[model samples]
Target chain A: MSLFHWLRKKLLFLTRANLFIAIGFMLLLAGWQVLSFYTHEILLASPAQAACALWGIIGTSYFNENFLITLWRLFFGIVSGGLIGFVLGTAAGLNEDIKNILEPFRWIMLSIPPVVVVVLAMLWFGMGSKMVAFITSVLVAPIVYVNTVKGIEMVDEKLVEMARLYKFGFVMRIKDVYTPAIIGPLGAAMVLITCMGARVVILAELMGANDGIGYALGVTRSNLDVPQLFAWVLVTLGIVSVFEFILLRPVEKHFIRWKL
Target chain B: MSPVISFENVVKEYGGRKVISGLSFQIHSREVVGLLGQSGMGKTTILKIIAGLEMPSDGDIKVIAERVGYVFQEPRLLPWRTALENVMLPMIALGMNKKQAGEKANHFLGEMELSEFTHYYPSQLSGGMMQRVSLARAFATEPEVLLLDEPFSALDLQMKDAILSMIEERLLVQPMTVLYVSHSQEEVMRISNRIFMMSSGSKLDELPIQHCRAFRAGCKKAFLKWTKQIGSN
Candidate 1:
């Protein structure tokens, strides 16, 4: 495509919502720049210093290796955990007995700290990607499970009765009724899980694992490279944003187009 | 002609309170039966039992229809689907392909005079429009048996009259066995071939009247007198 055509196409995707988000980001960056000036360089990195550090990190082979590792672990962790949660949650949502049986497990999972889980995971899986992924999945599953149960329970009874009267088959009931009813809640839960997943993965990697962004952050922290530490944090935030905005948001928007 | 629906001593209880006790009724194929009763008098319960949404605590209920359609009091359209899509759902459930379902949905929506509003969501539509969508959805399925549980009760008189006329027109084109439960005597009189009054005891008493497709002054007078008799009882 010509430059003008490409530019027009891109501009069509931009709306007032994007403009407001851009302005809000600019204001936040300005605030951070002001705050950095008030503190020592070693204590707080300026946005410029962090940006320079991030640019430098991106050029290195270490960045590619560690970032890929973290991304892969995050992908596997979320998929496995989310699937298990969805299946169990659907069962629990349908049957009171299953819900009751799973209640204590959900409680324990929610109540237990990530630190404790990381420590336990290390003992079980050893110092590797497995440990980090396991910890991430454990933290992610309960959130998804709880939201799924709530979503299913809140499906309109009248609609269900209508479905029954119409003799909707099992697959049709799931596709037309249960899936749509749960998508709203599940979408919100997914956004929450992505951010939470990123944080827990890093924490787990930092505590137990030998590679990934968390390990890189740990290395920077030990060397007192504040700008590099901030750079790693930026990269983590970028990944989470990509997962949420690029991946989840489009899927959510497609499913809930009627709302728009 | 064999009855399409037969209820034999059907009894239902909710938490030890007998809502329907030994209710018996039979509805033949293509019969449009209007059910009039006071609130909380098992009118809805009877429809539920017939629809198999609620199982009777005791008795044998036989519904021989291959397909049943229900127009609930509330417009229970899936909020995420458009008007046309909502009408297509039951057809899709019956294993119709998307193209055929879509065509049928469009035809039904057109019949309801909602051809222009086919893409509107339930939340975007007005209350009367939503109810019309519900009616279209029920009709699109080509049900052998249709149960209308006060489908127009939430509508205003003006909208109610328009929809009742649409229903009467649809039934003329495509006749189905319908058990219509409504509180409005005028609405019941306009649509029903026979009117049955249900009492608190879950017993049905058939009221004798010359069946009319449209509400007339003479039938209105007779309906008022029968309603007054019911009230007095």
Candidate 2:
């Protein structure tokens, strides 16, 4: 294909909703610029000032070190939680007795406040990244577990019956029938858990940790560095958006290509 | 020769509703037996019972065959699997190695005239094509007994004829006992050695097709008369 035509095709794939999102973000920047003009510089910095501050820290060792630490904690917590949740949820789906046993625990995990969990982790682990990781997993695992269980429950019963009649063993049935049925919902849950995990990790760090993005934010708050804080927040949002749209969306599309 | 399947006074009930009551029949080896019944007359239940997918509430049922192939009313191809994979499914499940199963599946798909569409997914195929793929899947296992539950009920006349011809050709090469279920008398009469008519809460009646084959015009007249009677009731 010609380069211009290829570019046009790619642009066409961007829906009107994406255009609206871009417009909305521009409006937010305009609003921020207006607020910064009205307010004291120390209280609310202008978007331009924040952008300059962001550039200053973009490649610095301080920013990179904190960002990498936070990223690592987020990844570890989500991966560990997602694995445990998927295994347990799938088991519950296959066996009614196991579902009954796990029902109360899932409910308890979902209902408990994340702040309380963080506090408990802090008390147990003595204020470190370990506690932050524990807090994030505790906060995110229940969402994954609940969604996975629901996904498995919603699988087509007729397909299961067909599998059984064809003498499909458990593994074959899972790979051929059950996995496809659940993958869509699990993909959706993974997206939710990743975003939620990032937020929870930052919150835990802000509360107690000495390192990472949350700690950096804590230091900026004490220093009354409004531009730096805004810069850090924007960077975090950019990372999450990249992870969600560029990475997870493509992976989800791959998993559900059969549907297309 | 022993019967391939026998149901001795089998009874099946669902939530106090008797779907099949005191049903007794024997399908002899290598015979194509058409089971004729109206909608919701428990014909499918009988097939399921024979396939061991459902158990009889009472009495004895015996299927002497080691392997049975079932073609459902709707083609139940796994949407995620391609036509070739769907055809290979049962053979692989029955412990055939992947290579042999692939060759067997390919041969059956060829017979069903689905060789060109082997890589297509179920969603990509037309209804007739999907049903043909389903037939290929059923025959790929090389079953001793084939149970067809209105397999052509959803197809148009031309598609139906094409499928019936394909099935007829397959049966000619390798004879197997078959229990063909359908609502049309003419369809059953065209293919079956014997026809069994079923009604709710009534004993099944068996009609041999040997004399009917000798007198084709007379058999058509009788089929029309029987259909009219059924319609009036």
Poorly placed runs, candidate 2 (over 4 Å): A1-15, B214-218, B224-233
lDDT of 1 by residue, B1-233 (tens): 88999989988999999999898889999999999998988998888888889999999899998878888899899998899999998898889999999999999999888999999999999999999999999898888999999998888899999998999899999999999999987788778888888866557877775424324444466656666777677
* Model 1 agreement with the true structure over A145-251: per-residue lDDT tens digits: 99999998999998888888878898888788988889999999899989999999998889887899999999999999999999999999999999999999999
Off by over 4 Å in 1: A1-31, B210-219
DockQ (model 2, Cα): 0.64
TM-scores of all candidate predictions against the true structure:
0.91, 0.92
lDDT of 2 by residue, A49-88 (tens): 9999899999899999989999989888988888888888
How does the DockQ of candidate 1 come out?
0.70
Q: How many Å off is the CA of A39 in candidate 1?
A: 3.8
Error of 2 at A203 (Å): 0.9
Model 2 chain A: worst 10 consecutive residues (lDDT sum): A13-22
Error of 1 at B43 (Å): 0.7
Query: What level of docking quality does candidate 1 show?
Result: medium
